[model samples]
Target: MTELLSPTLGGAAAGLGVAMPMGAMSVLLLQEAMRHRRTAMAAAAGIAAVDLAYAALATGLGPWVASHIAPVEAWVRLASALILLGIAAHGLRTGWTAPTPPAAEPRGPATPTPPAFEERGPGRSPGRPAPPAPSGPARPAKAFARYVGLTAVNPTTALYFAALTTAQGASLATGAAGAAFLVGVGAASLLWQQALVAVGALAGARISDTARVWTFRLGYGLVAAYAIKIAFPLPTPG
Candidate 1:
């Protein structure tokens, strides 16, 4: 019971730790929530689903990677450190450049210009009719699938799960304990994602662009520090 409980707790902590960072993805989630509640909820679920998948995969793969890493431990660590540093650098760059959400769009009663729509035809002609604009709300299922792919492709997140799995030890990655851990990860991540969506839907406009920028910077800064720690390990006591 204790063994299972420990992994479950660890997985919950791991889930929150990974999901708490507010990056571009978080901003996008918030923005969508403000405009389309159903789509945003679906997206949040998709993101959590990906996290659960990554956690499960990591739980199974970490032990194998550790066993085989002895021959090239230094190289593997170096590579992992580099990957993390790259992610941090990209995050920092985007943090400065990422566009503010629609909430930050100029607030004044002015006629907004309609952007030009794309024309699909064999050739441009005066008689060619522009495609009709979409008249309905965004599809929730599409949002779900899109977010699932977006979350799945995030390398930093993948590495995070891998790190957590390796740290959790092989003993906890089997049978009931493993199942408990996966459940914890899924539940915690889903709850967090939903909370973000709710906040966006309820009061996203209250958040400032500066706050978003700083949040992104801070999250990536921590990642960079972790990468540095990995790159330069402390010497063990004799």
Candidate 2:
């Protein structure tokens, strides 16, 4: 088992290589974390789960998947680009709307008092702001599902895993080495994704609402540019 540690270390490096890029999926994860900090762990778990699964597949059928996916890579890129654009548009739309506060009745005077906790709703408090509605989907489960699907469709992820596994000879890892390598990749990906979630939470806490909206707009623009580049890439000259 000690001898297999080398493979495990290699897998960790590969995970970092694949996950550290600033892409649309990463942007979405950060935005999701900022929106629902409590559920960010779940979203992070979803990210790791897909990574683990992909690592396993790469270990098992790396060569076959790599060769087969190359032919259809363009289609996958298009799909991912479209999904990113859709997410960007929806987020912009949601950001435009202001959160609605409960209407208040005048308390024996011309001025209206803000609604009390009970007046707002059950288990609600004046100190706490009303929760922002989720941008992509209504609930955490849906968000998790959305992340899993979106991340899976990213062609770069599959290509990354396929290349990494092939380079590391994952097909020959066998037994303990194989298991360790898979675990190592999963651990690395999980750690990085959770860190992103924490950073996003801090950003949400420290920044003003206007800053959040503007940052989101900036990210959306970048994602749109990436999508456009992927969708209509320039032709190579002979």
Candidate 3:
């Protein structure tokens, strides 16, 4: 492992460096922080896991995979773009149709009624309200699954690792050197993603109630924008 130090640090730096750019995934990370304040860690873990896996794949077998998959690159990009668009559309619909918080109950003579969904269950008093269901689908495991799926299909990630590994040539791509680089990548990726989660959570905390609602609406819009950008990138100059 000591011999691999150089490669590891190099890989880690590269991995962390590449991940710093803000994008659709960043939005989702921030969203998770805002929603499950406590579970952001889990989501971060998931993001890290995908990063490490991609790093390893890029270093270990990127050339072979890239070559074999080249034929279908366009399809993969299209599918990824479509998936993003679908998610954005669903979020937009859900946000639009979401019920407004019920009016704060007036204090005084009449007892206030609970929202229909929050009505008391068996063994509970009629007046007692049930716990509300989660506003979005962001359980830790689900968040993890989501990141894994999104990152897996992200062509840019695969290409980044592939380019880096291939650029190292045969000399740097083998044995202890290669191992070290992968290690570095994993470490760097872990650190960066966790920081993003923390930052997101902090942002979530600072936002006002009204801001939270608008933020959600804005996130959906941004995601849709990302999807459109992905699906229809501008043509390069001739």
Candidate 4:
């Protein structure tokens, strides 16, 4: 019990620490939350899923994975940077474009209705006001898949977990201890991501549409800057 508890707690702490950094993924998550809370949560789940998988891999096979990744770390970083830049470019493009207006109803529909009878759709009644239409489909599933792919491409995640496993001297722990650790990591990261999402949602509720657009632009700008930094990182002092 003690052994399992130790790894679990350690993993939780590590997960929080790693997730606290405001990387491109973080920016994207916040932008998503501001627009669609449900989609943001889905993206958060994706991030946590990747984090959990990485934690498990690191705990069980850190040395081997790290060794293999070391050979192409630069290429991986470059690829990640390119992907981020592409996402940022897309965001900027969409943000600048005017929203499409709803199309006019077709002219051929002229069904006669009785004066006394009211047409009520599902989950709606005669007295109650109709619920506001959704601005767009939440598309949470698509967001989940996109975020999962984005987070998976980030080499730093795997490397960071691998480093932690090596430092903790638990890289070979693949039994109950590792499982507990992974659960802790997933829970902690998910909680943190959700907290971020909540904050963004609240801010979105208070802001104007113009403000939201500017905020979205700022997020993509930050992501672009991060990508540039990753593509050409500063040299460390000797």
Q: Write the per-residue lDDT of candidate 1 for residues 1-238, one digit (tens) a residue.
A: 7768877876776566566556445656666676667888998999899889988898888757766665555455566566666766765665455433334222333212211221110011222232222223369998898778766756557777666555433544466887888888898888978987887788844256666556556556655665565554433334
1 versus 4: better TM-score goes to: 1
In model 1, what is the error at residue 131, expressed in angstroms?
Answer: 23
Best-performing candidate as measured by TM-score: 1
Q: lDDT per model, in order? A: 0.62, 0.54, 0.52, 0.57
Give lDDT tens digits, candidate 3, residues 105-175: 22333222213321110011223233332345467777677666655555545644554554343435456
lDDT of 3 at 234: 31
Where in model 3 is the C-alpha error above 4 Å?
A: 62-137, 205-238
Better of 1 and 4 by lDDT: 1
Better of 1 and 2 by lDDT: 1
Q: Which 10 consecutive positions of candidate 4 have the poorest summed lDDT?
A: 115-124
Clash pairs, model 1 backbone: none
Q: Which ranges in model 4 have alpha carbons more than 4 Å from their true place?
A: 63-138, 170-174, 205-238
Error of 2 at 157 (Å): 1.4
The per-residue C-alpha lDDT of model 3 at residue 195 equals 78
Q: lDDT per residue, candidate 4, 1-238, as tens digits?
A: 7768877876776566455433345545655676678998998898888888888787777535434666454555566567656655655564444332222122223211111211111111123222222233269998788777766765556755655554333333457776777878899888878987886677643223465456446545655665565555433334
Question: What lDDT would candidate 4 get against the real structure?
Answer: 0.57
- Per-model clash counts, in order, read 0, 0, 7, 0
